[model samples]
Target: MKRTNCKIAFNDKLLMLFAIPLLSFIIPIVFFGCRLNRQPYFNVARFFSTFIIIVLLWMVNRYILIWCRKRYPRFSDVRKRLLIQISTMLLVTLLGNNLLHYILTETIFTENPVSVFDTDHLITSNAAAMFCLIMIIGIYESIYFMHELRSSVQETENLKRENLAAQLNALRTQVNPHFLFNNLNTLISLIPENPDHAVDFVQQLSKVYRHILEVKDEKSIPLKDELDVLHAYTFLMKTRFDKNLEVNVDVPAEKLQKRIVPLSLQILMENAIKHNIVSSDKPLQINVFTDNGSLVVSNNLQMKKQVNESTGIGLNNIRNRYKMLSDAPVKVTESETNFTVSIPLIEQ
Candidate 1:
């Protein structure tokens, strides 16, 4: 609803300097046949009149173009902007031509006046007006289309950079000393209690880091691949929380090939554990599955009585990443008993 500066990326001043006079000279000959063997070799009066009309039309249409661009600056509004610009220009061209003829014939030439109603004059004049209108509009539209295309590409790149930053921040949080110490304690305890599982735990921990490094630069990954990595990350969390945190993944085999944003499930898993109560007394349950054409993550709402405030960086990161890949939204639904997040899946 706000407005941007009314500027087109094109500079038409020099263009108009050459184009207006050229159109002025050519329109008369193109629409109404010219005779070379006339008294005054060239009709300076007619040329001057046509030149004035062409200049008037050009100025009006140019202003309309700038106004429309300012009013609807977004790429999404291009259709509406073009519709308004062209319709308004066409009306102005027709009316302005008629008005200019009226001024020249009725106001200036009294005795030997031109017939403004002559069918030949009407047809030629209207045809010439349309020719100039289309030529000018075509030039403006072509430049605008290219500018918008470039702008869209730049915006997408900016989003990608921000998404990458968010991912890096999440990565830092994971490898922070606190996380390493907790996992180290778990591994130490496991070595004496169950040496085989300790070996499995170390392997899973490596898999989690390896998965993160693999997908850190990826856009979308197959659901099967994501789930494999997700299980690895969950294994590490399960080692820390034991039976207090439970994650169930239930995607059909056929749907495993469908794709999603990289590391989405793990972020949701972490989010569930962070805000909710995950203890022996009140275990947290997080479910991952496919619904319709989307991947869903839902967790029961056994919230902590006093927890650090949520910044929503995790969910927002996935959302921004998804926007670059698809128009489908990352949906979040919250109820008294549970919280749900649904991410649309992409075809392989």
Candidate 2:
């Protein structure tokens, strides 16, 4: 729904071609030569031959409304574009008032050619040139639809402040400082060797900071509340690589109410545990699921030999917040033994 080039501004078409033929020659010499007694020099040769037949039917109705903006574009079929722009403005207002009554009663102000079937001056000069071509195409389509509705409400408030600054930069790369100093040095050595798995790893780090403050201004969420914040972020990446991290999550309680984007599966599982090689001899894994309607994820690879260089900006901020909330496209892929991504999903 974006096509808007109805051109016009060469200094507003040289100020409407020198102010509409000087207000169409001072409105028929101030109402037919000073209030009705007519003939102020035959109303200046019939208002300059009806301002050259209303500037040749206003340049063929502004090139048929700029070719009906590329054959009726803005959201298409509006009753077949008002029945082809009111039947081509009633056939260019009946051929510009029958060629301005045969150029004022016969060729350029009379010598012989008049007989253009005058049917009462062609229905009163084609109903006053079809009411000035329907008030010039209804004031140029209401100032181009109020400047395309204020540019679609300022591009939807700049994509809602760039989707809330990419959900607060994916919750500051999931509580950054090197992922909260490796989950507080794996909760200070599991609070003295597994104090009840360090109280469920501080309740899965307060349930992944309470699901990032309950879906930070959510543009999307569900997939079972993003798989309950990816099971508290894979239980703090399985207590920082316990048995070298796994993940799985095959999705499908009827595609878990399908929706996504907000921290898109914990920023693609923290970019597969930040660039791979999770430990016990390359044990990463990952996965996540749902296929046709998208979601996917994947993983595998195993790069990490001093990995930190990736400035990917969290999968380009979840592919620009799923292109401002959906139409589908986010894919990714890779191969030589997996990397994937996919995404789509949003339906609810």
Candidate 3:
């Protein structure tokens, strides 16, 4: 899952607000009541009273923090919030101490049981101090949790980006090797009858490599630049197949100025050739045009029964690359007699 900075903070704040008060109230009452031999009723009353106070404090503190966050332009600072929590805890502890001192001195059960605190008539004051201490501990835990959440989110995002880049690079590696092997075979087949065309093939192959190298690190290239490479590629295939291959291009001149994923057209062309049989008797017809906001490549399928070792990587690579750039998935359609791929055109 992709994690954003703001989302982590938001989640952490919510979890902290709910979890801390419950833990603080439950843990101390259970452990300290047993150790001090307090009656169950007394322990239960003390727990409920403390719980209510803690809940009130949590609400007030959260409201103040949220208000500060909205009012101040830079209230996102974790350090400042931590300081505020510490200061609030100290202030609450001092106020509670004074209020509890008065309550313990003037209230019932002052003389029957021993003073809860070391000093006479200061038991409530001592309880108040303990409450403040628990609050301070909760605040520290919340801060720690928030920090850890931030770090985890950042690391996850970094890993996701790196994985995406690696996959893209792997796809690129397959393309160059696949293209080279096919073009080399074409050159070999033409060597005996047309030595001149074979020489031209070698030059075209070099130009293709040069173009690939130029845009190897680029995420996308201008449509015109991609078309120039596509034309060079088709020229090589046409030289080898001659009249056996029929190609048509009908893109709007204005759209050629836009940007597209590099080698997108090349991938579609290769897929068409790999799946279909092309010869003088049955020439393969491939068409390129635009519909709506997409560049469409369609080919009449005269499929060969015995297909080559197809890894199904070309279409997958193109689809993944486009996904990174656009919201729409690259559209693919296959029928008994035709195959079409529609790729979204991106503005520069």
Point to the candidate with the largest TM-score. 1
lDDT of 2: 0.74
User: Pick by lDDT: which candidate is best?
Assistant: 1
Q: Write the residue-wise lDDT of candidate 1 on 97-199 in tens digits.
A: 9888779767654433568778878878888999999999988788778877888799899888878886786677678787799899999999999999999
| All-Cα superposition RMSD per candidate | 6.2, 14.9, 10.7
TM-score leaderboard ranking:
1, 3, 2
Q: How much lDDT does candidate 3 score? A: 0.67
lDDT of each: 0.85, 0.74, 0.67
Error of 2 at 181 (Å): 6.1
Question: For residues 1-348, could you state the per-residue lDDT of candidate 3 as single tens digits?
Answer: 435234224444555566656644664455335233644333544554445555555555555555444443232465676577557756765565555434543463243343434463354345545665666457645664676677757855664564355445535644567666877788888899789988888887777768877776777899999888888889988976789998899988999988888877876787788788889888999999989999999999899999878654577667766755666679999898888999999877
The residue pairs that clash in candidate 1, if any, are none
Model 1 Cα displacement at 307 (Å)?
4.3
Candidate 2 ranges with C-alpha deviation above 4 Å: 1-11, 15-47, 50-52, 59-83, 86-90, 93-113, 118-168, 178-225, 228-259, 262-348
Which candidate would rank higher by TM-score, 1 or 2? Answer: 1
TM-score of each: 0.68, 0.37, 0.52
Backbone clashes per model, in order? 0, 0, 0
Instruction: Indicate the worst ten consecutive residues by lDDT in candidate 2.
Output: 2-11
TM-score of 1: 0.68
Q: Give lDDT tens digits, candidate 2, residues 1-348.
A: 444344421124654687578757754554334234632354556667778777878778877876765676654364687579778877877876686667566656773244677565466566667766787777677776676677768877877777788777767766779878988998999899879988988898888888888889878887887788788878888877878888888877898887887777887888788887778888898888888998898988877778786544577677767877776789898888889888889888
